[model samples]
Target: MGSPSSLKLGVQICGVGYGWGEWRHPDVPADASISLNFYRQQAQLAEAGRLDFLFIADSLHIHEKSNPHYLNRFEPLTLLSALATVTEHIGLVATASVSYTEPFNLARQLASLDHLSGGRAGWNVVTSWLSGTADNFGKAEHPPHRVRYYMAREHLSVVKGLWDSWEDDAFVRDKPSGEFFLPSKLHRLDHNGEFFRVKGPLNIARSPQGQPVIFQGGTSVEGREFAAGHADVVFLNPESLTEAQWRYQDIKGRAACLGRNLQQVQVLANIRPVVGRTASEVEQRYQHICQFITLEDALVTLGRPFNDHDFSRYPLDEPFPDVGDLGREHLQGHSEHIKQVARDEKLTLRQTAWRFALPQREFTGTPEQLADRLEHWFQQGAADGFVINPWPGGLQHFVELVIPELQRRGLFRREYSGHTLRDHLQLSTPINRYAPRRELI
Candidate 1:
C-alpha cells in the first residue's frame, strides 16, 4: 500500500458566488462566471502549468437575501460538462450536493462527463449546508444534520452501485449477429432504503474513474467519517501545518479501519496566494485589493460563512463582539480560520470579531514567498497538495506571477500528462466492478 502523503499537487477553483472582488480586477476578464471561453482559457492555463485538475465548488441553493456581488453565475456540473469539449487533459471537478440531486440522474451525468472527457471527471460530493436550498426543494427548513447525513450515506451507496452496473466486457460489440450489449454483463441494483428506492443498472455505463473521483468537505464529526469511508479526496480548510498533519493521518487511519485503501485518497486544504516580485510589493498589492472591497459586503458574506453575526449596521473599524466560543456546529468548518485570524492579526474582542475583515485579501506575497509557502505547506504536511482556492478575478495574476515561480522551483508540472482529466490525476480507467478485471495477470 502506498502512503497517502505520496499524492502530488492538485488545484481546485471555486465560484462560491462571484468568488471575490478580483472579478473586477484589471486582469480579470469579465463574465468568466458564465463564459465558456473564460472557463476554457483558465483550464488551458492549469493544463499548461501541469496542475493535476480544475475543480469548481458549487452550492445547491442561493441565499434569499444575497447581495449583488454574491449572486449571478452558471451551474458547475453543466459548465464543466460543456468544458469537456474544449480542454483536453485538465481534470474537470464539479460540486454536486447529495442532499438535492438524485443518484440516477447524477450517475448518468457524471458517467457521461467521464465518457465525454475520456475519463477526467470528478464529483465533489457534498451534504450542503443551506436551509434556503431546502426551501427551494419544497421544504420549510433544512432537515436536521443527522437526518441529511443519513440520506447522504444511502445516496452515495446507490451512486456507487449504479456506477458499477456494467461489467467491463458488458459491451461486446458483436457485428455478425448485430447484438451491441450483453444483458448478463449488467448488475441490477434494486436498492430500497430509508431515504430512496433506486432500481437496477444505471442509464449510462461505468465512468472512466470508476466513480468520478469522489471529493468531499465538511470537517464536522459526520464529515470526517464519510470522507474516511468513501471520499477519494478531502478538500479541507485547516489553518496550520499542525492541524493539517493531524487531519491527514487521522483520516488515513480511519480509512484503514474501514478496510479501504488509504493511499488513493488525498487531503487538499485551501490555499490562496497573491504573487508579486517582492514581499513588500506583494503586501502592497494585497492592500490594494483589500481597499476596494466594501466592508458591508464582506460583513454580509462573512455573516453566512463565518460568525453568522448580523454586521449590517456595525462599523467596519469599530470594536465588535468576539467569537471566542464558536465551534464547527456554529460556524460550519470555519472555526479554525476564525481563530487563526485572531492570532495572526493580534485582535481584541472587538477587533477579532471580523473574519478576514482586515480589509485585506488573504493571499499576498512575492513569487518567492508564495513558492516558499507552497514548499512549506507540502513539506510540513499541511496538505499532500493544495487546491488553489484563489479569490475570483485573481487567476491571471497567479498564472502570470506565482505559476512561473512554482515551475522554477520544480513544485508544479511544466506540461500536461494526458488527454483526459482522469489521466492527469493518475487515476486508472475504472473497470466495471460489475465485471472482473478482464486482462490476464
Candidate 2:
C-alpha cells in the first residue's frame, strides 16, 4: 500500500471574486458578496470537509472593463483575518503580488494571519505581469519579466528573513521582569537588494506555522524556476491524465536539474466540476449553466483564454486579424493542445475557445466518480491534489456530497489530523535560522 503520509491533497477556493457565472447562480445567496457571514459559512463548511487549506486569490489593481464582474469582492488578507476566527484546520492562502507589496508589510500580514489561524496561513506570490495594474501603481508599464523575477527573488529573500526575525521562543511574556518579549531573540534584517531596501524586524513574532506556507503557481519557464527554488506548493493546468503526468514529470525534472528536492513541493491543477447522480442529469445541469452564457459573452470569452488576449474588445461578429509578421511563430505553449482538442471534439473556433475558457481540469461525473477520478490522478502522479473552483451555491454540494465519498473510501481524512493547515496538509513547519541546534535546547 502507498504510504498515506505521501498522499497530499488541498483545495483552493475563489473568494466572492470572479468566478465566471458564480454570482448569478440561483443557489448562491443573493447577498453573498455583501455579507462577511456568507464567507464565514463557507469557511466553516471547508473545515467540516477536512480540507488541507482554502486559497484566496487577489490582484493589486482592478481591470477596466471586467471590474464590474469581479472587483466587488473583499481583499484577501483582511477577509482571511476574519475567517481565521471561524475555521480550525484549513490554511488561509492569499495571493499578494511581489511586484506591488512591501516585503516587510506583506510578511507581517501573512504572519499575523498565521497566528490568528493558529498556524494555518499561506502566501501565493505573484509577479503581476499586468501593465494595467502597474500603471495604477504609478509606473508607466509593467516591469519586464526578467526584472520582475529578479525583484521577486530579492523580495522573497527579504520576506523570509523578516519571517525569521524572531525565534519561535522569542516571546517571553513573563510578568516578573515586565519584559513582554525577549530582546535577545530578535534579529533585524537589514535587507538591501537591487530592487528593494527593507530594514526590518517584523513587529509580529514568529508565525504559528513557522512561516505561512509559500504557495505559487506560474507555468512559464521563469515561473517554474521560481517555484522550484521557493514555493511549497506549485499549481498547474492539466487537461488530461497524459497532460498531468507529463507536466508532473517536467516539473520534477526541472527541480532535479536545479538540485532541489522534488518532494518538497506540491503541484495542484485547477478544476471546475459539474456533477450529478446520473449522466443525463449532469448534462442537463451543465446545459442550464450554459444558458447563462450569452452568444456574445461566449464569443467574447473565447478570445481571452488565460487572460492572454481580450477578444471581448473586438466585436464578436467581426473577422480576426492575420498579421504579416506574426504568421506561426507566435503560438503559445498550449496551442497544439488547443488544436488537438478542437479537432477531437469537432468544435468550431468560437466553441473550442469558450469551452476551454477557464483553465480547468475536467471531471464530470457523480460524487463517487469524482472521487475515483481524483484518486486515479493522485496515483498516476498527474498531480499531488486539486484546487476546486466552486460556482457559488454549489460549494455546499462539495461538502455535502463529494467530501463524504472521499472520506468513506479513505481517500481523504474523516477529521483533521491536527490543528493548523500545514499539519492537516502534512507539510513541514519551516525552522528558524539561528535557532539553538543542540540535541536538547
Candidate 3:
C-alpha cells in the first residue's frame, strides 16, 4: 500500500500448458504432459523472468474425454517436491483438496516441501469440484456445496493447528548436554469438529516461512467468505475488467468486514497471455491453435462444468439442452457462467462448444501493448497480480519479450528481493500460534 510499484506475478505450469489442444501443437513436445524436464524447463524460465511462483493445478479424477494434459500428468505435491530441488527461489504452488486428503498428512507434506525448498511453497486449497471424483474416493455421492465449504473451513483449522504443533525453537540438538528437543515446546492439536477429529502434533517442525502460503479459488458466496477468513491469496477467473474490479472490491471488503487487514489477502486473476511481435501474428497464432480443437474435444470441455454431461447426443445446430439440475450440486458457479454466456449470446450448442474451445484472451498484442493492459489492470485496482497461463510456444516469448517490457515499465521486479515465496509476494511471515501467552495488563 505504500507505493504503486509493487506487483506480484505467477505463471501456472499447467501440465503440457493451458490450452486444451496445446499438446498437439507443432511447437509443443508430444510428451510434454509427462516429461519432468518440460516442467523443469518451465520452472527455470519463470525463475529467469523473476516470477513469484509456478502454480500446478490438479484434479483427483479424469474422464476419457478429458484434455490430453489432464488425462496424463503428475500429482501436484509429488511433482512440486521434485521441482523444489531444481529451482531455488521460485515459489512452488500446488493445488490440493481438503475433500480428498486428511489434515494431518497434508500438513506434514506441505511443511516438508517448505523445508526442502527453503520456504518457497504455497498450497492452493480446493474443495475438489470435479464430477466423479467422489466415486474414485469410495464415496457414492459428492458433498453439497455448503457441506464442502464447511469441511474446508474445519479442515483448514485443523491443518493450521497441526502446523503450530511444535514451537519454532523446539529443536535444541544440544550434543554437549545430550538434549535434542525441549519437551514442553510440543503441543498436540486435539481438534474435534463435525467433519474430522485430528488428535496430534504434526511430526515435522515449522519451516522457515512459518507455514506454506494458503491460496483459495472459488467465487461462490460461501467460498468468498471462507477465503476472506483463511486464505492469504484468492485466485479468480473474472471475464472482464469491470467484473475483476467488482470482485476485487468485494473480496477485500469481505476481508475487512471479518476484521482482516485488506492488504493481507491478495487477489490474483487468471490471465492467459497470447503475445506476438505483431497484431497480425497474434491473430494467426490464435487461429492456429483454434484449428487443432476438434468438435468432440470442444464438447468435452463445454460439458466439464455440467459434470461431463455429454453434449454429443444433441444436434449441434440446436440450442443448448436444458441441463435441468445437472450440475446444481457441483460446479454451480462455473455451470451458471456457461449458461449465462449461452443465454446472453443466444449461441447454438456448436457455437458454445467452439467458444469454450478457444482460450480466453486476457492479453493479445505486442509486448509493449500487453504491458499497457497489465499496467492498466494493476493501477486501476482490478487485481494485485495475475496468474498467467501461457499458450503453447508462448512461455519463451512471454519471458523473453513481455517480461522485459514490464520490467522496463517498472511494473515487475528485475531481481528477487528475498528467498521465501512470502517475500517475493510481499506478504508477511505468519505468527506462530503456539507462542507463549502474554501477561494481562
The C-alpha TM-scores of every prediction are: 0.86, 0.88, 0.96
Error of 2 at 137 (Å): 1.2
User: Per-residue lDDT of 206-260 in model 1, one digit per residue for the tens?
Assistant: 6555668888886777788888888877877665667788887778788899998
What pairs collide in candidate 2?
none
In model 3, state the lDDT of residue 36.
95
Clashing pairs in 1: 22-393, 120-421, 120-422, 167-435, 274-363, 320-350
Candidate 1 versus truth, CA RMSD in Å, comes to 3.8
Pairs of colliding residues, candidate 3: none
Which ranking of candidates, highest TM-score first?
3, 2, 1
Please name the candidate that would achieve the greatest TM-score relative to the true structure: 3
Tell me how far the alpha carbon of residue 318 in candidate 3 is from the true structure, in angstroms, after superposition: 3.0
lDDT of 1: 0.69
